[model samples]
Target: MSAALKIGFENPVAQSQAVFRAVMMALARPGTVRRLDVPVDAVPALDPAAAAVALALCDYETPVWLDPALAADLQVQEFLRFHTGAPVTEARALASFAFVPLGGEVPALDDFAQGSLDYPDRSTTLVVAVEALAEGEGWRLTGPGVAGEGRFIARPLPADMLDRLQRNHALFPRGVDLVLTCGDRFAAIPRSTQVDA
Candidate 1:
């Protein structure tokens, strides 16, 4: 007798490609936005959006970090290892990638990377999975990629962090990159874009 095998419609590699395309489109559009439904559960830290971000950016070259609340969860860690093939790293030393599952308050942005005057690219790229995104309520954005000016609220960022980013912009082309992941949607705010207080 022959046995039947089970197969499902979800393919991570395909999802990864779609994610890449979406991210590219977002970059091309700049302030524009897009959403993706990733394969994952609705949980404390690891949500569908978070999973989608991993699918798009995380790979062997990337390094990941989870908040203490969700860091040691075997399922989360193993899934990250299995899919992204990335290793976990310390918060102080930046890896190619970083995930802030803060789940509450975002840390001081400078704690991450603001880049150096010489090699601004040396700064870290941050992936923050947050609750939501809205306009005219968060921080004010100006400079490249933006029209005249834009405003958005992100909780309440630390004063020092704003200062660091200001310094990063002084370097112009050299500075840290940002990707804000909310739900299944994401926005990349490259260092080239200036955030004004």
Candidate 2:
């Protein structure tokens, strides 16, 4: 928890570990959205796991973008600034990392990164903190990491997100990566995962 702030009654170290576990499970399961535990020990707009992510990932070298709706909260922003020394930027142009709060309109999937043909790894990532996460009637996912093809839905995702992600896969190693977080749970779906609607 290097230089991370103590949000509230919750332990920052414990929260960070929980997030790590959630992301690991999500990458393994693909389309399945898992639930994270949110202890009522923090302030509004700052979920325990979300705060943990700021602690774990953000640093001077990593630029982060949170939804503007949350920008008004100097407490949250200052906490991030003091703890991570992360640069904040606009949604569409955010480079490496993003933290999207709930209630605002979700951005177009392409707003982040889809990588590139030669350097697919250069794409940006969005750390969307959703209201809740659960399995839904989403497009079936079947690819390198999946055991078999299956239908998986997560929201609130963009209307054209699936299509854009498909196109992103055409670039392969160059497409953007994602981290979907809710409560204390999160999952990372790298560009390598193939999505078919």
Candidate 3:
């Protein structure tokens, strides 16, 4: 079969539910790495975890924005649209969810919607495919989900990632949340988390 027609979750409902739970748990425990073992046929330009995020969270109502490389891949577009029914958007600010590659050029956090004060939850969820995901090292994280503090790391992210994260955190109740994925593992850094750069 063509890459564009690649299968999504082997068991749609069950797999999506499992992936969703993993993603939520990661977010709720900020800096915690969760494994997404959902079986999915590879889609061009997207890591398995990234595709899992889309399948579990995206729907017809959510508009998605992909970085240049991902956006340019027609097969990736078809696979996502077919399985998730998410619209591909060109305007970053209009995106409900945006995907970027850590090893490639990534847009500034501000580029995506920072929802209004009255509707901060409307902000975009940034899903970044990174080179690595690990715990107990790198940036020190603290805030809500964290008990005392947590350490998280992702490789090949921009050199100014910490600065960008600090700025996003400063936005408080109105900034985009982030999910970093590598291979079949993923982790989150919600805007509420403070990064000790």
Candidate 4:
């Protein structure tokens, strides 16, 4: 194996708590941007926020699926294994979580684990690394979390992302959730959220 990349929280327990809280808040209030504060240098081929999320949420019990570029990077693989102990999977449908980089052709929503009507929580959670994440005009989100409507803007999303998300929402309690990451910030879009582009 290649030399493991240096990346992980300086104070693993405390940092993980902070990251978890941020992620929880983001998921609770879908489309609300939140910052993740972890004391770790950025790893090559992985976004800082994405790395933070992995360290916060993944463990031996979780199966992670890396996108093509990340899967080819030994440094990232080693770093994740050493720090998170999360196993990597070759099957997208079996992944508990998936890391998808920006500027690539995102995999089809159906390619991932959509869970089942009886156990919707078993669906995969997507951590999408984007070039930028902001609150503005692009997609209008409305659901349980939003007081009225939530607006989120991320550049260079998949051409059919909105349509796909809509379809996913239609699946009700059986679709995947999404977490958009950029640098040290992120936002969530649960499967229950309604997306209008």
Candidate 5:
């Protein structure tokens, strides 16, 4: 089989379900890292966790936008299209999910859809590939899911990540959400969470 056709959940139904749970739990407990139960073979310019997110959460109804690095890779595009049936969109604001490969340039928070006052769920969800996910000195998180505070440390983050996150959080119900991925591990920081450097 071609490489593009080779990447997807080993057991479509069961594995996707597991990945879905892991994703939800990551979001439910902001700043907490979760590892995917099943392995997702890496695509040309995509991380395993990012691939898992696309396979498990995206479909024909969900349009995805790929960063420059990922968009330049035909095999990565074909793999996502073949497995998820999600159309690749050029307009960032119109995408339901945006995938950014490691070292890829991330657009400004306002570049993506921020939903609206009446329907906040319409906002975009960013799946960003990072160098690593670790504990210890990093951005401090609080609010909603966090008890008192939570630590989120991912390398190669945008210099103004905390500022951007603060602005996103201020948007409350109408802001983009982020999922940071590395290898097979992932973590989330919803719009409801507050970030402090």
Candidate 6:
């Protein structure tokens, strides 16, 4: 087995708890960047923050869909499976979570699972690995978690991301959420967020 497959939280319980808290805070305060402190050696073709998110959030109950680039990486697959126990799937709509790499082609927003009105929480949550993440001049975000409006900057998102997010927001109580990661930092953009480019 490769080193990456053996690399997981040194202290599974505490590390996972920290990562989970960071994830919750990020999602609770959209556009706010939170750092994940888990120690992960470089996993080939996998961003550390993305790996940490998967370790914290995915489990047997959550079926994950990987982008082609990530899906082809055996090390990444092994690491996630060993640590998260998440089932991998090729069907996007059936996925409860999806991992997409920066600069890769992303599927249409509608392609992911958008939960029914009765159970909006069943929708997929996307963990996107980006080149960089910072607060500055990029998309403007406003909605539930924002005090007023917040600025978020991440490079190489989908060309039609803003339009898609607008439409996604229109879905109201039934749309996917997003977690953007770069290195050890991540931020969230929930379905309740409105994005202006």
Q: If scored against the real structure, what TM-score would every candidate get? A: 0.75, 0.77, 0.96, 0.95, 0.96, 0.94
- Model 1: per-residue lDDT, tens digit, 122-192? 66676666566665555677876667887654423344756766675665675566666776676766677
Residue 62 lDDT, candidate 2, scale 0-100: 76
Name the TM-score of candidate 4.
Answer: 0.95
User: Pairs clashing in candidate 3?
Assistant: none
Q: Which pairs of residues collide in model 2?
A: 36-184, 36-185, 37-184, 114-175, 115-174, 116-174, 120-173, 120-174
Lowest lDDT sum, 10 consecutive residues, model 1, at 1-10
Model 3 Cα shift for residue 114 (angstroms) = 0.6
In the range 1-197, model 3's lDDT, one tens digit per residue, is 36348888889899989999999989999999999877867685788898889998999999999999888888888888888899999999999999986555879999999999999988899999888889999899999999899999988888899999999999989999999999889999999999995
Error at 146, model 3, angstroms: 0.7
lDDT tens string, model 5, 70-134? 88888887898788889999999999999998999889988998999999999999999898987
In terms of lDDT, model 6 sits at 0.86
Error at 108, model 1, angstroms: 3.2
RMSD of each: 5.2, 4.1, 1.4, 1.3, 1.4, 1.4
Q: lDDT for each of the candidates?
A: 0.62, 0.67, 0.90, 0.87, 0.89, 0.86
Where is model 4 poorest over a 10-residue stretch in terms of lDDT? 36-45
Error of 1 at 105 (Å): 4.5
Q: What lDDT does candidate 1 reach at residue 190?
A: 69
Q: TM-score of model 5 relative to the true fold? A: 0.96
Candidate 2 vs candidate 6, lDDT winner: 6
Tell me the TM-score of model 6. 0.94
* Regions more than 4 Å wrong, model 3: 1-4
Cα RMSD (Å) between model 3 and the true structure? 1.4
Measured on C-alpha atoms, candidate 2 has an lDDT of 0.67
Writing each residue's lDDT as its tens digit, candidate 6 over 1-197 gives 67535566788788878988999989999999988877865465767778777877889999999999889988878888888889999999899989997766778988999999999888999888888888866889999989889999887787788899999999989999989988889999999999998
